[model samples]
Target: MSTLLLGVNGQVGHELRRALAVHGALLAPPRTRLDLTDLAAVDDFLHQHQPDTIVNAAAYTAVDKAESETALARRLNTELPDLLARYSADHEAVLVHYSSDYVYPGDGDQPWHEDSPTGPLSIYGQSKLDGDEAIARRGCSHLIFRTSWVYSARGSNFLKTMLRLGGERDSLAIVADQVGAPTPARLIADASVHALRRYREAAELGGLYHLAPRGVTSWHGFACEIFRQARHAGMALAIAPERVSAIASDDYPTPATRPLNSRLELSRLENAFALELPDWQSQLSLTLHDLLP
Candidate 1:
């Protein structure tokens, strides 16, 4: 079987390149060759390659910047996925796509389920929701994994940002109001492979699932843990864990609004695939080891 993986350079895509390679022959094209934004080019390539499975890991992730660049964000987050979904349906191929936790309303403290009602607060979230809806409407064999607080050793994510600021500054303030599991990209990739295997065995296994590591933490708490792990890993940091202060979301205003509640329940995913996800701290520590010396 041949699999086409998009966004190969991204945090999750980078790890997926390794995880998906074991399953079958994989085709991961860089943006220069397979630009998702160019519909005609992407359609032409898909028609020519005709992959059995297409894993779309690419997304418009600039949450704050997306508020201003609405057109670009919509094209990437909504239109592109719609096109891919149609292509998957036409080719009778399995479509595996990544989504965000921002689809849920940011009000409640309860963990969001796959069937939870969605009320996106920002344009980025709305676009993602639209994409998810469009994919479902297309009636293709697809697996949509809604994950949150994703970080990796290689990417410019929250973990790396904290590590950089920790080394340069004596003190830092993180938004404690925002809560979610700090999911590792490696874990997501592994879970995707597991889900793919199950889907191949039973086509009914393809659907929306909340895939996140167990346990939860506020942004401030996550930042504190990062410093602790980095310090234990013999990495130098100017700011101590105790020096990091927790602040409200209002304290740090941005162009786009973020969901205070990003926690996602993973029982549906675990039960379906018979997989036990590790705790967020454990995954974070492992990633820190890779990021540090």
Candidate 2:
């Protein structure tokens, strides 16, 4: 099967490039060559290439910046997916898309289910939700994985930011109210490959599923764990674990209102695919090993 992976340079896409390659011939075009924002060009490329599987991992991920740059966010997060869904429906190809847990209302403590009522708090979240809806409305064979707090050793994410701050600063403050799993990009890539295999074997497996590592923690808790793992990995840090203060979301204000509850239920994913996802801490430790020198 010919597989076309977009956003190969992104956190999740980078790992997907390797994982998806083993399944089939992978065509991961650079942004300079394939501009997903340009609908005409993307449509032409899809028609010309006619890839059997299209994995869209590209997204405008700047949560705060998205408030001001709504158009750009919509183009990437909403319009691009709509275009891809249309193409997938026309060509009868499978489209694998990644979504965020931010689509749910952030007020609750309960883990979001696949059928949870969505009430996006920020522009970024709304755009992602719109993209998910567009894909579903297209009536195409697709798999939408709603994940949360994604990070990787290679990208600019929370883990990397904390590592840098810990080494340079004497103290740091992290929000403690927000809670979610810090899912590693590697896990997402691996799960995507596994799900793709299942879909190939049985077409009925194509649908929305939450694909995050097990367990949950606050932002402060996640940061503390990152430092703990970094120190265990022999990485030097100026700031001690206790030096990181746990602050409320109000203390660190951003343009976009963040979701306090990002926990997503994974029983659907586990039972459907017969796969066991590791805990958040286990995956975070592995990623820290990769990240630390």
Candidate 3:
């Protein structure tokens, strides 16, 4: 049973390759090898690979910059997956894809469930939501895992940014209004592997699931923890520990509007897969251990 993995260089893709070591053959092409932006190339790759399962972790994740590149972002995020979904349906292959918590407007205090009303605030979010709809409409055997605030030791994420900035400035101001779990990419990959097994076991085990590390935190709180862990690791920093001040989201305006609540409920994942996710603090500690300079 051959499995083809897309976006193997991305954060979740890299970790997924590790988690799915025993799954089967994996085929991930770098951008130079195959540009998913080319719809025909994507279709040809799917047809040639003839994979039993295809995991798409690739996404146009430039949140602020995506405001200007709406068309390209939609092509990569929505159209690419729509093609994959059609292929998977035709070939009878299981398709696994990753999505974002940004699908929700983040206006409410309650955690979002799998069936929540999706109202994306940014072009990035709208593009992802459109892709989700495309996959569902294709009627393929697929699993879509929606996650948020993903960080890894190797990627350009919040943790890395905080550590870099912590070394250059005497003080820092982070948006405190934004709330979500600082989910480690490894956790998302691991859960994907588990869901893959369940997919193989039962044909009916295919749907959208909210996969995130347990607990909730504001951006400021998450940043504070990152710095605290860096300090405990004996890492030097230019910013004083107390200099990390909390500010509202308005302080850091960007091209795309952000959701105030990025939190997602994982009851469906837990109930269906019988998997227990680690606390966000634990996941952060593990990721920081490798990233702190």
Candidate 4:
């Protein structure tokens, strides 16, 4: 059974390529060979490859830009998944998709369950919701993992951005109101493989599950932790020790409104897979080690 992994160049997709290599044939084509924006091209590729499993990691992740690029965002985030789900249903293929917590309303301090009511705040969030809805409505054998605050040792993310800015500036003002776990791309990829194996063992385990680390923290808390770990790792930065200031989400304005609450309940995933996810801080340490020289 061949597996087709999309977004192989992305942070999560890059890690997935390595984590999933031992399973079977992983057909991870680069954008130079396949443009996902083109629905016709994607359909053709699906028909030609006929992969038993389709892992969709590619998405229109430009949250702020997506407000203006509505059509393109819908194409990649909604229509693409719709086509893939239809194909999966017809061909008896399994789909593994990575989704965001932005699909929620971004209110309340309580963690969102897998079956929580969804009310998206932005065009990007709505697009993802549409995609998820399409996948579920198709009734195909699928696994939709909703996660948030994703960062990594590689690629452009909050962790890397803070490291670079901290090294160059004396102080930074980070948004502290928003709260969620900082998920590593490596962890997401690894959990996916584990969940897939468990799904094979119990067919009933096939459905939506929230995927994230155990604990949660605000962006300010995460930045402070990052700085602390960087200093502990002997990395010199221009930012003074504990010089980061906490600011409200309103202070940090963006074209797209960010969800204040991104906390996703992991019991469904942990119970289903019999796994205990590590905390965000510890995961940050591993990613820090890989990132800092």
Candidate 5:
């Protein structure tokens, strides 16, 4: 049976395709090949492919803009995934979906568990949480891996942003209040592949899992590490560490409020799958190595 992968264009999707290349016959549909917004097209594509498994990595990720375009975001984040989940349930296909750490309430500093009460502060977060519920309600064999602060060498992410700013600016004032694991897309994809390989044999699985790097760090800490690596690599930086002052979340107000604690409890995943994600610093170093010219 072939494996059908959706959202082949996103960072995670791209990395997943590369990692899963040798696993089986992979059928990936980019936006041009398969428009997920079109229900008819989605239904048709699933019917034709009839894949043994489906991995959905595509999402409407514009956090600030989602506040204005709530309807569009809901359609993509909520309805579309539900449609795919229903199809997967009917076909008895193993469905693997990616979720975010934003689903947790921004109130505390505790590492969020899979069963924690969800209280999304922004429209995008709310929509994503809704999508998770939608997928779970299908009652199909599924795994919803919730990850946070995803970055990749090839995609637009916090690490890439820091690289550009490091070269251009004298310093950057990053938020120090918000804390979470800075997960690499490659690691997330690798973990998904690991979990899916044991889907059938693992009895304690088939539920949500928190998959991120072992340690957590704020955005300010992440930027500091980025520059440190860049300098070690002999890359010139205009900014100095002292100039990179830490600021509160209110200093840079946005259309949507971000979670103060995006840290996720990965005990369930580690205990069940015996998988341990790398630390944020190590992952950042590897990603920067790939990004450096």
Candidate 6:
């Protein structure tokens, strides 16, 4: 089967290319070749490629900037997925799309189910929700995996940012109010491959599922662990454990309001795929190993 993988340059997309290549012929285009910002260009590329399967991992991920760049964010996070879902519906193809936990309102301490009441706090979150709703409404064969706090060894993410700042500065102030799992991009790709294989075995498996590690922590907790692991691995760092302080989300105001609760329930994904996901700490350890020299 011909699989068209979008966002090959992204954290998840980069990993998807590696895992999906073994399954089938993969078509991953660079932005220079086909600019996704151009809707007509995206539609044209879809027709030209005529893929049997499409995996979209690309997203407009600048949370704060998305407030002002609503049109651009909507184009990528909403319109692009809409176009792809339309194609999947008409051609009878399977679509595997990535979504965010920001779709849920950051109110309670409980983990959000796949069918949780969505109340996005920012333009980025709303756009992602819109894309997901569009795909569902299209009534196409699809699998939507909503993940949280994605980071990888290779990408510019929270993990890398902490490592750099930890080494350069003596201390850092991280928001502790927001809580969620730090899902590795590699894990997401592996699970996607497993879900696709299982979905092929039984088509009824296609639908929305929350994909994340088993446990959860706040952004401050995540940064502390990152420093701890990096130090344990004998990596150089200037930040002291005590100096790394935790603050509330309100202390660090940005253009976009962040959801305090990003915890997603993984029972649906686990039961459906029959896989045991690792905890956030263990996942961070593996990613740090890959990153630290």
Clashes of each: 0, 0, 0, 0, 1, 0
lDDT of each: 0.92, 0.94, 0.90, 0.92, 0.89, 0.93
Models, CA RMSD each:
0.8, 0.7, 1.0, 0.8, 1.0, 0.7
Structural similarity to truth (TM-score) of each candidate: 0.98, 0.99, 0.98, 0.98, 0.98, 0.99
Off by over 4 Å in 1: none
lDDT (10s digit) by residue, model 4, range 145-165: 998988887789999999899
**Model 1 residue pairs with clashes:** none
State the displacement of the C-alpha of residue 102, model 2, in Å, after optimal TM-score superposition.
Answer: 1.0
Which tens-of-lDDT digit does each residue in 19-73 have in candidate 3? 8878778787888888989999888887887898989999999988889999999
Off by over 4 Å in 5: none
Off by over 4 Å in 6: none
**Once superposed on the true structure, which residue ranges of model 4 sit more than 4 Å away at CA?**
none
| Angstrom error at residue 217, model 4 | 0.3
lDDT of 4 at 262: 92
Instruction: Point out the worst 10-residue segment of candidate 4 by lDDT.
Output: 194-203
Please give, for residues 176-261, the per-residue lDDT of candidate 2 as tens digits.
Answer: 99999999999999998899899899998889999999999999999999988888889999999889999999999999999999
For candidate 3, what's the RMSD?
A: 1.0
| lDDT of each residue in 1-293, candidate 6, tens digit only | 89999999999999999999898799999888889999999899989889989999988999999999999999999999999999999999999999999898989899898988999999999999999999999999999999999999887999999999999999799999999999999999999999999998899899999999988899999999999999999999999999999999899999999899998999999998899998989989998999866
Please estimate how well model 1 matches the true structure, expressed as its whole-model Cα lDDT: 0.92
CA shift of 111, model 2, Å: 0.5
**Tens-digit lDDT string for candidate 1 (1-293):** 89999999999999999999888799999898888888889888889899989999999999999999999889889998898899989889999999999998978899888998999999999999999999999999999999998899887999999989999999998999999999999999999988999989999888999999999999999999988888889998999777899999999999999999998999999999999999999999889878755
Query: After best superposition, candidate 4 residue 290: deviation in angstroms?
Result: 1.0
